[model samples]
Target chain A: MPKLFRKVREIRNFLRSFRCSNDNSNSIGFVPTMGYLHKGHRELIRRSKLQNDLTVVSIYVNPLQFGPGEDYETYPRDLERDLTVCEEEGVDVVFAPTDDEMYPEKPTIKIEIPGLTDVLEGAYRPGHFSGVATVVLKLFNIIQPDRAYFGEKDFQQLKVVQRLVKDLSIPIEIVPVPTVREEDGLAASSRNTYLKEEERQAATVIYRSLLLAQKLFSSGTRNAKDIKEAVLRALLSEKLVSKVDYVEIVDEEFRIRDDQVMEGDRLLVALRVGKVRLIDNWRFGDEAV
Target chain B: MPKLFRKVREIRNFLRSFRCSNDNSNSIGFVPTMGYLHKGHRELIRRSKLQNDLTVVSIYVNPLQFGPGEDYETYPRDLERDLTVCEEEGVDVVFAPTDDEMYPEKPTIKIEIPGLTDVLEGAYRPGHFSGVATVVLKLFNIIQPDRAYFGEKDFQQLKVVQRLVKDLSIPIEIVPVPTVREEDGLAASSRNTYLKEEERQAATVIYRSLLLAQKLFSSGTRNAKDIKEAVLRALLSEKLVSKVDYVEIVDEEFRIRDDQVMEGDRLLVALRVGKVRLIDNWRFGDEAV
Candidate 1:
């Protein structure tokens, strides 16, 4: 493991120097996160190590993405613990930039997906994807990674980032890793730590609902409305799941589905367990559904 | 003049190639334009050539920016004429890409500046700047120019592009050139050709209002509202000026101004002459206003 300093200017200068270095055979892969490293992040770093000569991991809890009432300040953060995990995972560089370093000046530009953003998380929290798209694009430019990894737990965010890269013709290739789940099938997230013991137990219904829907889809239940209804019923059964934001069966491009589970289509579900919102999705292939 | 043939596999391929080439030198200056080259474009090319080692001019009339009822099909296009002018200007590369070439896949990504966009041209035609930002960002990546030039003729657009570059940290310097105008003070544009002889003569009010605002600001007119009112009155006087879209004195960042002209403040004016819309602006400085 190569230990790199943790400063934005230093990291940028280092990248510039590396570009001019004599070593022309090394390729760098980057995985950007918002600290509180988990198994999902470790998996991303592990894949980066396996594929590249160097791996860079960035941890920034971007304030721009959080709404007025959202958890910007209260969001989980632990640099020391994150660094240890990164070291264990063989990360070559850990770029943890300060807020000022990331945004020297106020950002006036915004990236927005109109119709797509007006639904799901975007509907719940307006301007969320715009913030995600802006920050992710900024990171991609600064890192100039040959490849970057994003977990599919934030399926909508992953889709938005993919669209941004495709639309803007960003040079970096985005590799979306599968959503890492707990043993109980709940999608692993940094926010999952916010759940109380009983709330944590009740959070299982989110995954349970998704699993039930998946099972239904596989067992000759192809109607999207029925699956959505079943998932809603399962989530409502859990007292801790205060709100069912949306349970959608969408096509690969995130377009809402009708009656059938076409091969390669995805079923995405989002639910608010206490104060924490968790999202997960599973793709249906011909063999499975 | 170095003419290079670009066989772009994708926009990313183009960006990567440019990045590798740019790292070895100061890189080229870029001027992106919709085809239908006129003397105004030549002026931009001249400025680009003077400022950088190489000049790259892109001729792409992005379809995304055009509204449904807007003159997308009837929009002026003359690639052969544009090529002749570019060749005469000693442009290093002329990136005349097909719509298919520019958007290989359907574009799902959109970039928008809300408050700023909700007014001005964005107010007139919904989602215009989103399309402009998306295409401009795509071109910025494809060309990877050290400095990109945008005419102040479209003041709102210039501000939006500047914001995009700054907000995204897109490793390119944005250089806003002065609006090139005809002898009658009409701002030159590719769309200028759409005007009939009478309408063309009447189009002078677009710049006339801007000039009036500049004159007032220079003559110790410190109040923004007063200057705006003066410009609006001047534009409204012209019978051929069908609609006065907006006339405002704003700060450099496009924020609405109240009182006193800051040294680096800007005065923007926009109006419709017959069916064509035109915009212009002037910076408040010793030599400018």
Candidate 2:
């Protein structure tokens, strides 16, 4: 069983002591999650466990990341089953802090990446990336991991985290794992659980739109407008998709690409199917940057 | 001569290699400065040297902390003499990056403590603490020290750093050294270099007012308004004193107090004599908390 921690001080003390011991491989790799463990989380955990001496996973459904009318209160959480998955994956430690433990006081601290986080998902969910950056930075400090893992599933989030570490000189290396998918190409997400069987089938259209952007890009379509329109058309084709939140084409740096789409640019999509929002992205060209 | 580093990657690598060596004392103490080492900085370095196995003094004038029309261009920089001070003080290393090195690009990451920062020195100098917090946090991560020292001369800066660390869980212990004063009781500062002969003499009133606050509190006065009025009167008595920015009394957490000031509560003041701005603070009662 992975060692469980609720308080920040106790785990810091533990990591310090662990560092002094000969058994400590001296490298801690972290994977932060919002629980309700799924295949995407497993891939992140598996990668961390492979690359580092010790792997620690954080299970936090951060309320700060959710906005008004968002599913923060109803975010799926089953700690017992999540712990089972961690134990199966041989995680070294698990930090599962209570709300009081994580935020003893109403937080006054805010971390923002101005231009990078103000578009796409950031545009849709104001203060969402700020909250994500704040909590992620806090976790990075608390864990003091040599390298941390983030899934490409949250592409904008991954970019935000990467830029955050780069801009702030955070010492941890961020390892980006590819988005895991089901047989029909639906991105594996904890939010996927919220979808009904029919809604789940409709959700695959999100990934299909991403692939459609890739297919268009591959077939001599360099114009972001042409790709975006095609992707949006595909999403709208799915009658159940209640809302097409955004179909954005941004370079690796989240610079909006409206006309010419170059290699390494990503097409990100967000759509709601039967009240469940699903988001996915695909890099332009053949290989991922 | 203390070893010098101008790059973040270089210092981080050095610290890592040093950590693995048996010769390392297994502890690092950091004192970040703006060069032109003064007695207050010397005291901070002295305390760091005494408490840890190694001491690092970073001598970079962070441009971010200076607002438009403020003292960024004119702030003191005498690296040759500053290095001499570090060598004499038995410092282990000096990480002094140039402006381009410290901020290669315009910073996007901002760390803000909203309610706490929007008052005191924060109010007078907008985006000041945000800049301070951003740079300090970046340096802290770059130099992963066991402990970092701050001077109470910049009382609000110290508090801001403390709150920043607490809020972000930065895993660094902020050790605040007492404000080192000159023979006339004025707080030691780099900005004092800008003061002319008569202006220098007038600045002593800032500290005198602090002492007066202590005396008034000791003699059974708890009213913050009365103490603030007395301090303001004393500051205004100096003919050369230009402006009284603020004379604030706040509890330990920077909750402003207008009525009753209790023990451990601090009286923070900011004033200008000539073109230079100076700030100082005093705890209401003796036996500091």
Candidate 3:
């Protein structure tokens, strides 16, 4: 059974004790999540376990990250099931702090990157990245992991964290794990549970468009605008995708590429399938999206 | 001889090596400054040395903290004299990175407190605290010291750092040393070197006013407005005190107090003596300011 900590202080003390005794290999690997574990989260846990001597998982549905009317209240959380998943995955510790524990006082410090933050997801969901950046930094400080793991599914978020760590000179390596998807290619997300049966099935179109963009890029289609247009067309073609929020081809740094798509570029898409917002992305060289 | 590190990566490696070897006593104390060593900085270093097994001092003239038309270009710096001061204070290591070394790339992530940041010195120097907060966080991440020392002279900055560390759950403790002053009662500062002989003589008014406020507060005068007015009057009485920036009485957290000055309250003042800007503060319970 994995030890469960609901208080920040308790978990910090527990982690410190573990850190002190585990001097032989202090490579602490951390995977921060918002609970409701799925195959995507398991993949991150597995990667952390393999790369580090100790693996710690944090499950907090950060209210700060969700904007007004953005499903914060409806976010899926099953502590029992999440604990079971952690134990099965051989997680060293499971930190599940409440809203109060995470934010004892109203947070005054805001972490943001200007140009990178004010576009794409940030453009649609204002102040969303600031919340993510702030909470991620707090988690990093609390865990003080040797290396932290983040899935590439949230491509912009991953870029934000990478830039934040690099710009701030935080002494931790951020390991990016490829997104895990269903057999039908729908990206694994707790929000997927909110999707009606038909909407869930239709959600595969999000990934399908990404795969199409990747395929086009692989087949000598170099223009970023053309790739984005093709992705937009594919996404809009789906009857269930009610709205195409954005379809962009960006380089590794999340900067929207105006010219040719390189080997390491990213194709990111976000859309609404029956009112459920979904996002997916794929790197150019990754095994088919 | 204290180890000098100009590169972030090299200093990080050297610090890590020292941290690994000196595991028994990991009480690393840090004092971060912008060079031009003074009695105030020396006081912080000495306190760090007295309290911790190892004391590390960083001297980087952070450009981010200075806004347009500020004194960043003219900021005084003397590395040789600073090195001698650190050596004299028994500093274990001195991390002094150049502008290029510290800011290898443009920084994107900024740390700032909302209400606390918009008043006092923050109001006078726009983006100053944000710059201060950002650099302090970066240095804190790099050093990862057990206890970090800050002087009470920059009282608002101390409060901001305290709030940041607490809000972020940064495990390191913040130790505040009292402001060091000259025999004439003027607060010590690097900018003091820029003062003309006459302006230097008149600079003592900044401290005298604080002492006057302290005397009044001790004599059962609690009205914040009254205390502020008296302090302002004392400052304006000095001919060389060209301008009075602000005089405020607030709690330890820097919230402006409308009522009486009680225990743990802070009375802060900032004024200009000719071209030189000076600041000073006194806690209610401190002896004679």
Interface RMSD of each: 2.1, 2.3, 1.9
By DockQ: ranked, best first: 3, 2, 1
Taking the tens digit of each residue's C-alpha lDDT, what string does model 1 give over B1-289? 3364334454334444554454544567899998798878888899899988778888888899988898889888987788888889998787878877788897876666767876767888897888898889888777778898888778888888877777887778888777777788777788888889998988777666666777786788888888888878888898988987777777866777888777678777667888887777777762532
Each candidate's fnat, in order? 0.78, 0.74, 0.67
Error of 3 at A12 (Å): 3.2
Off by over 4 Å in 1: A1-9, A17-26, A238-242, A285-289, B1-7, B10-23, B196-209, B236-239, B258-263, B284-289
TM-score: which candidate is best? 3
Task: Name the lDDT value of residue B132 in candidate 1.
Answer: 90
The TM-scores that each candidate's chain B achieves against the reference are 0.89, 0.96, 0.96
Query: Which ten residues in a row are the worst by lDDT in model 1 chain B?
Result: B4-13
> Whole-model lDDT for model 3 versus the true structure?
0.87
Model 2 lDDT tens row, B1-289: 9999988889988887666456334788999998899999999999999998889999988888889999898898899999999999999999999778877787887777787778888888898888898889889988889899999888888888988887777878899998898988888888888999888888888878888889999999999999999999999998887898999998987899978889999998888887778888998786322
Score every model by TM-score.
Answer: 0.90, 0.94, 0.94
Error of 2 at A241 (Å): 1.4
User: By TM-score, highest first, what's the ranking?
Assistant: 3, 2, 1
Interface RMSD of 1: 2.1
- Which 10 successive residues of model 2 chain B have the least lDDT summed? B16-25
